[model samples]
Target: MASVVNNVVAAVANASNDEAVCGICLDALDRKRSVTLKPCNHQFHRTCALQWAESVRPDIDRPCCLCRSSVREMVGRNGRRVVRSYPFEEEELDMKRQVLEGLLNEGDSFLISLNNTRDQIRKMLKESEIERAIAEKQRQPDEYVVDIDQEGAKLEKRKHAIDNLLEYGATITALGDAATVACAISRELEALNRSNSDLASEEEDGHYAAEQSHNEDTDSDSDSGSEEEIR
Candidate 1:
């Protein structure tokens, strides 16, 4: 085991000290035209790596062929490279949060508008009621017989207006109720998505832990076998 580790270390040291061939093109690496990737320290021709990076879709980072290390920067169409610097998941999460916040704000505004409309409807009904009462109280018995038709017409018109107002108010109230329910359902769905995501992450972590434990146990058994052979 020690010899294997030493051999791996020596290989890495030699690669770092000497100029190695480009992994992609399998040709000699030029000192000025080569790039050493981070973390992996694998060397490759700058042009060859750039071409490889550009061949893959730009939406995802490219991984090194030799060590599978992530290459966060890619050569753009205009030959400019930009660093991602942040995780894609984090960016998506931020966008979702912004959208949810906007939805909540719009919901608040809608509710406020509905409340104002209801208040205006109530105020109009109260004013109309008070006017009707005063007009009736001011009428004399002689005037009542003469203006009965006119009064009836006015009352009918007023009643129609009141009925229309009530209908409009009811429609608006129903819409508001529906909107409230929809908002609640959306909230529940968002929570369910989050719960499912968390569960999946937990399962993945448990699987990784189990795999690592198994690997360690296998290594231990191998070491025991070597010790017995030496004895």
Candidate 2:
């Protein structure tokens, strides 16, 4: 059994990609830089693969970073190789579970930040238009031009962050090697669904906040009228 495991591991060591890049680190794979973490024949940067194997959560299969395949060792029992993950796989799996939770939290945080920025832009649009209308009636210069510039800057920053995120997603989707990407692709489809849900939630929250603010403003106006009548 030991000999069989050694042989398989040895075979995996020789697997190399011809100028192909490691999907995780985006580094070129060659004899020096690449290694195939076996049971799944995918080549990655030695460091990248180690980091990937290290990243697997406790409950899920120890996945090859590129393919999400179980990178288990075939243990020989009675001269027959049986699939049983290595000891590290168990540890890695636990660690991976933590990371999965962290990723979900991070995604929610990102959506919150995105929604806040969208709300700011919405508010700014209303303020700018109303201010411009008031200025035109009085034949006065629009004093909020600087505010508009600041809002434009904010919009540009938001756009750049979104663009980079989209490009990263595109790169992940463009990984065409079926043996190394199919499983990951399915997870990405699920991510797309989560993204849609996030957007819907953002829209609902925005509408609710707007309504609350409008009601508060109406109450403030009524209180001011009552004070004037008292005076």
What does candidate 1's lDDT look like per residue over 57-142, in tens digits? 66876677666679655432224442222112233334334333434556445445444544554553454365345546765344
Off by over 4 Å in 1: 1-16, 74-231
Tell me how many clashing residue pairs each candidate has.
0, 7
Candidate 2: residue 210 Cα off by (Å): 57
TM-score on alpha carbons, each prediction: 0.26, 0.24
Looking at model 1, how many pairs of residues clash? 0
lDDT by residue for model 2 (1-231), tens: 656544444444544535565555544453223455567766654444544554655467676654556776322212232221222223322333333343344533544454454455455446546644554675553333443344345545544444444344334333444333445544644554454465667743222101113343433322222334554
Residue 197 displacement (Å), model 1:
44
lDDT of each: 0.46, 0.44
**TM-score of structure candidate 2:** 0.24
